[model samples]
Target: MTVQLRHLFALATCALLLGGCASNPPATARYDFGPLPAPSTSSQIGTLIVADITGPTALDTEHMQYRLLYADARQARPYAYNQWAATPFQLLGQRLRANFAQAGVKVLSTTDAITSPTVLRMEVNEFTQSFDTAKSSQGILNVRASLFRNHRLLDQRTFQRSVAAPTPDAAGGAQALAEASDALAADLLAWLASVPQP
Candidate 1:
């Protein structure tokens, strides 16, 4: 074949190979929260209802999120093949309820006929794996919490925590996030206990 024809044939082969690789779906990995600190049955501070936590629509799914602080700090991205076993809100709510029980708080469901005297509502503002630089990353968790009694607002506060990842990959991020989540839950329960009951 002529030299020009040979070059064209080589380019076509490369494109075909690359296209095939690109077409293959990447492997997906799922993650979830670690075992919670066990439930508490001894203390009954008061019956409290934990309303479903709300957050940005983007976080309403099971996708794993990360922020590129070194590039555009405001931009959040999801891993193409990595996802949470459950959505962040669901996981957070589950952990928080478990923590409250462990703390001797009587947690109840809103639909129960005998309603709790107090209600805890929360909204998650930030939940992601943030990278300060290419070599470092951490799981960040921020939440806005509100307390209510007899349908009246009592207090509101925001909590934020960050835990460093053991590695810069999804597994590391998952571990860091679980730690941060547990920490946040503990803080919330402490804050609730400090609030005076009417």
Candidate 2:
């Protein structure tokens, strides 16, 4: 081919390559529990050890999961372009610790120094955003909370929180889930107050 023809072929090949790259999917969106209140320095109660949260294998992933109750309620689906910064189990634990600390309750991790302290352990039963209709949805969090003292179970109960989504999409689901987590934390704190302490 002539030089002019060869140059045109090279330009077309470069254009095609660039177009292919442009067609790639959008960047993934990562989310977290959002901003937190300043941690309190006062300790109304003794140091409390928060054990690592436990949950099903699915909850152990960073995927932002949801359920189409109006369609297939039994199947959980993950967002294609959105994800949590960490697993739901880890995010719940962090949120709980933050909330407790902000409430003037001393919070410690399981890895921290051990004492005959009050302990809080949680197991997530279900965590997902459920769409009841094409335009309505809510975030649902169900967990089993157990309080321990001196390695003895002081009290145990299950808590469930559901918060409506402002929108019917992933962004709304994340916000709803965050609010539901806060609600769950508040409930746990109230329950601890009413339970008989050792």
Q: lDDT per residue, candidate 2, 1-198, as tens digits?
A: 999999999999999999999999899999898987454333346568999999899889999999999889999999999999999999999998998888877789988888647889999999999999989999999999999898889889999999999999989998999999888877887887787655
Candidate 1 wrongly placed segments (more than 4 Å)? 1-23, 38-44
lDDT of 1 by residue, 56-148 (tens): 999999989999898999888999899999999999888888877777777876766656778889999999999998779999999999998
Considering only N, C-alpha and C atoms within 3 Å, which residue pairs clash in candidate 2? none
Q: What's the distance in Å from true for residue 17, model 1?
A: 11
Candidate 2: residue 153 Cα off by (Å): 1.2
